[model samples]
Target: MTGSIQRVALITGASRGLGRSSALKLAENGVDVVLTYKDNADAARTTTTEIKALGRQAVALRLDMADTGSFAAFAAQLKSTLAGTWQRDRFDYLVNNAGTGAQVPFAETTEAQFDQLAAVHLKGTFFLTQALLPLIADGGRIVNTSSGLARFSLPGYAAYAAMKGGIEVLTRYMARELAPRGIRVNTIAPGAIETDFGGGLVRDNAQVNAHIADATALGRVGLPDDVGGAVAALLSDDNQWITGQRIEVSGGMML
Candidate 1:
């Protein structure tokens, strides 16, 4: 481990969707990966298997982003995993991408539902970073997943978008604070993608797909890998100069 100069990234919510895609991309690019899943251990292990096929080190841990109390223990276990699996002390990148999306109208949005969104999206990001900041290497990178809904007002997503907007601002503050340590912070705001987000409506409903496709200037909904590649690129050493910015990967939607 002394002479190994490879970078390692810890991606939360890496069990599926965009996080899984990002993990695969980073692994393919020779970056070591530490990915986490909330529940689906089987799916997460499949991702790790694929990463190992890429010939890079990969490990998966159980993580629940909504449970803030477990973060310290989570961080400790992650550190142990890193030390045991990769023989490394500090990881090079941190992608705060774990979140839950809900589609509820403003009036009907219950206090419990709104709190759930705030807890996972806003509070989780804020506190999780605080907990894991020690393990992130100097001059590292942080990518917070935001949403295009934060830019354009979208109905039934008022609370979710608001929390994402908070992350946009938080990204700027993180960039400023971590810049001194050479750790760049940024947000990737993706448009509609074929993920299980919001009950997999886009993937299941042709009408939903049509509406999204018509809205998208690319004439198609985004793939998970679209946001994933953008994330991997943002964390790359190639993107050293860009920080504190929210880059939208929306396939030109809402233009």
Candidate 2:
């Protein structure tokens, strides 16, 4: 096992939003990071620079979660990166945080939309994790991103939330299967936040934001910090005993 000071994490979709925040939070705690971005190389570079400024090693790579065919190549590239950069064979943590949002009502949701959600949120996560398993050290950690919509009903989010629900179930299965290797797998189901996800509905629309705030016990919509901090804490060694659980960082929504 790598020493705590040398621990590294691979966070997907980390160019911005929760992933970016999580990467920074981890770096704040001395964890090196390799982050992935879908399209924005500039944003990814900025994240790496910030991590480097924090005195932690950082690398940014491109990854499209919806494309499973590219996972093998990504995994290969990751292996080379680990050797060339960190001189290590495996990383200590994996944050499967890359994702897209869908808001079509169940009745209006098309099969294409459903498939895209499944590909990005479920299939891609499953296979990418599988492909990267050999490079994840024993006693490592995995955090799969979920959504509060999976636990509570929210119209127009049926398809999106369903995929997250599947992820929650998958987390448990991964925890069970990977137990012998000492890998802990868990899910983080975040409440609506003010990110660019889902066309920024919750962030841009005052009525929607207010409605969410009223429903939440915290009386405010969540921010990237709300979730990124929780995820950072969860992946810390202090919470090693926790696995196969769904930790919702929703400020007590629907309670």
Candidate 3:
């Protein structure tokens, strides 16, 4: 997929979980990485070490998805990091993977909770990408993270899924507007992945895990690597023509 020309990817919230997996997969695919962590500096360092051990350069930065006011500064820091680390002004891939999770029933949902979700998942992604537009190389790829809940109904995920639904729509508009630069934008929706997300309900809870497995066509919940591999594949040169789409890495979940 990738030729001799080295590529670089920037993934937010990559200290652990799906973001960490995606960073490692891209490194394995010969792409250098710049990852961000909100508060877990130790985890971010460990991920960077892993990527470096793979013979690829990696860097970790601090980022908070809920702080849109800080995006301009973050972009400036990123610009400096790129210039110092790679001696370049642009990076080849951007994975908008930073977000928080909430699991409150709609009936109990609070205004603060909804605002926080929107701030991080919807508004944050939209403005962060806008701020970083100049630093993204022409013909680059952007994969915005969505969730399977956006398509399927789930009780406590009304707020979370709503933000992801907004992301799916934003992806199409991004693809259309960025087409002139030959950039590709798309969404990757993971279904019931066994991560620490949602307080590890899917990963640590037996009943929840069993229920997901029963509903999934593949008979199991998805792992982080399943989505990491998908991210690397989608950003590869082979998928140059595929953009403005929603690809679920859920092992054929829910039919």
Candidate 4:
């Protein structure tokens, strides 16, 4: 077992949004980070710099969440990178956070759109985790990003929410299977967060934002830190005894 005194976490989609915030939060909590970006090199480098500024080791790698065929190669690259960068062969945490969101009215949702979502949210996560399972430490954490929409169906998001729902169920299976090794898995379903998701829907549409806010007991939409902090908590040692569960981090939304 390759164990570092300070653990490591690999957060995908870390160039921006919740991923970026989660990288910083995890680094602040003393976890070295391996971050991945899909198509934003400069943004990824900026995040690396920020993580280094926090006095933690950080590496930014390009990872296409839709590329299921390349996952085996990615796992190999990840192993080499982990050995070279951190002198460790296994990482202690994995955050399956790379995903896309769209609001196409179901009646017009295209096959390409559905396939894209499936690739990123379902197949990519499933295979990547499977490929990397050998490199995960005992008592490790796996955090999947689900969405509040899975619980409260909004028009135009049926497929998107459905895949997230799949991930939520997948989390349970992973937790159950990995329990013998002491690995914990859970999902974080965030509410209406103000990210670049869906062309800035929450930031631009006051009515839509307010509707989500009114639906949430917190009386406001979520920021990236809201989800990031929740993820950090789940990854922390303080979160022992919590797994195989879908945590609703939407601040009492729609209940």
Candidate 5:
């Protein structure tokens, strides 16, 4: 953080949606990026290209958050990428934002569904951060994605919210433990947005969109840029003193 070199951020699920938005926002602030995608190579490459268009270095790497076993290899690849692309051995920001959604009632939610949620949202974030700890610079930041569902009641999101709730707690613990190293850890909980998440239920469903808009104080459902800008602000030097907190980017939903 003390050098003239531009800061680098590693953002997961940056192929599209909030992740893609976050990547571009950071790039706009002169931060280089190393982003990941699960299956969409073309979209990931497009995000990298867009970042380059912003005059910042960017790379897209394939990653499966649900597959924890692959993390070691991924970390190795990242280390290599960093040395080769940026001539550095460490990155400054780690954004744990890769995730999927589950929409089943508590009573009907299968064990598999719950496990998948835990694997991607909770376990993956935890272990992936652990794996990359050595490569993250001393005065770095970590932003883990949470959800408004964790704060307000929402049917069909019990499992997903539970994992995010765990992430909120984990953020505090990470902040405390990583304090000696000057590593700040926080969580961002975004409200319903018009994304492809959960089969675009909030984006494509007219009734659902209107319901969320009416419930929100802003009188509109959230958008990718809303959360993206918030993330860029959170990771900015202006908010360096803010850590171990859950900042909800929900447009005052369910309030």
Candidate 6:
């Protein structure tokens, strides 16, 4: 887009945590945002209010990542939203950041838990992007959320990490196929952060937080803004040459 046209971004799971921070950071950088939340309409409204406070247009919509069947409807709604709000039919950036957390050992992990993780993180992301392909602008960018666990060995994360690993691979393939449209696809892997994910183990538990901090090269667990800033940087015009790479925003964790 030209300097005169304000760009728009659609971020999934943006009601709170890293997603919320990413939306806010993009807003600070003068980008409008279309944020989605799974079940918390109030949080989504609050985020949009804050984005609008930053002098950028913002809207909130409900989206359940695990429901593949709803993606078509979601895309239609998104198209209408874009037309109504911006007088356009496409958005410039897409952040596939919606997901749920699970920490179950491989031996004891139930199929139900595994299915939920796969449905939300892997299957949901895959099909949702496919469903939204037409609505994404030709030169747009897509950021897929991965996890540091995919690269590092951790117990009770076999299923979750596996899904993330799949996401990393999918990023490479997406980058390759979508290159014709000048659409860059990359992965962002975040280390332990003090978020509500996984019951906030790293954020609320002093012992766990201290342990993670000790292992991290930066001497502290990640915050939402840590990842948010990296995401904004990755999607910036200056980073056009970079794609299909996994950029870890873990503050040098597990180095």
Model 3, span 37-145: residue lDDT tens = 9999999999999999999999999999899999999999999999999898899999999889999899999999999999999999999999999999998999999
> RMSD, model 1, all Cα superposed?
1.5
Candidate 6 stretches with Cα past 4 Å from truth are none
Could you report the Cα RMSD, in angstroms, for every candidate shown? 1.5, 0.9, 1.2, 1.4, 0.7, 0.7
TM-score for each predicted model, relative to the true structure:
0.97, 0.98, 0.98, 0.97, 0.99, 0.99
Q: Give per-residue CA lDDT, model 4, range 1-255, as digits (tens).
A: 233377899999999999999999999998899999999999999999999999999998889989888888888999999999888799999999999988999999999999999999998899989989999998899999999999998899988998999999999999999999999999999888999888889978989899989988979999999988989999998888999999988888889
Candidate 4 local lDDT, residue 62: 87
What's the lDDT for all of these models?
0.91, 0.94, 0.95, 0.91, 0.95, 0.95
Off by over 4 Å in 5: none
Q: lDDT tens digits, residues 1-255, model 2? A: 645448999999999999999999999989999999999999999999999999999999999999999999999999999999999889999999999988888999999999999999999999999999999999999999999999999889999999999999999999999999999999999998999888889999999999999999989999998898998999888887999999999999999
Is candidate 2 or 5 superior in TM-score?
A: 5
Q: Write the per-residue lDDT of candidate 5 for residues 1-255, one digit (tens) a residue.
A: 875977999999999999999999999999999999999999999999999999999999999999999999999999999999999999999999999987899999999989999999999999999999999999899999999998998888888999999999999999999999999999999999999998999999999999999999999999999999999998998877989999999999999
* lDDT for each residue of candidate 1 in 29-54, tens digit (9 for 90 to 100): 88989998898999999999999999
Q: In model 5, which range of ten residues has the least summed lDDT? A: 1-10
- Of 1 and 5, the candidate ahead on TM-score is 5
Q: In lDDT terms, how accurate is model 1?
A: 0.91
For model 6 the local lDDT of residue 141 reads 96
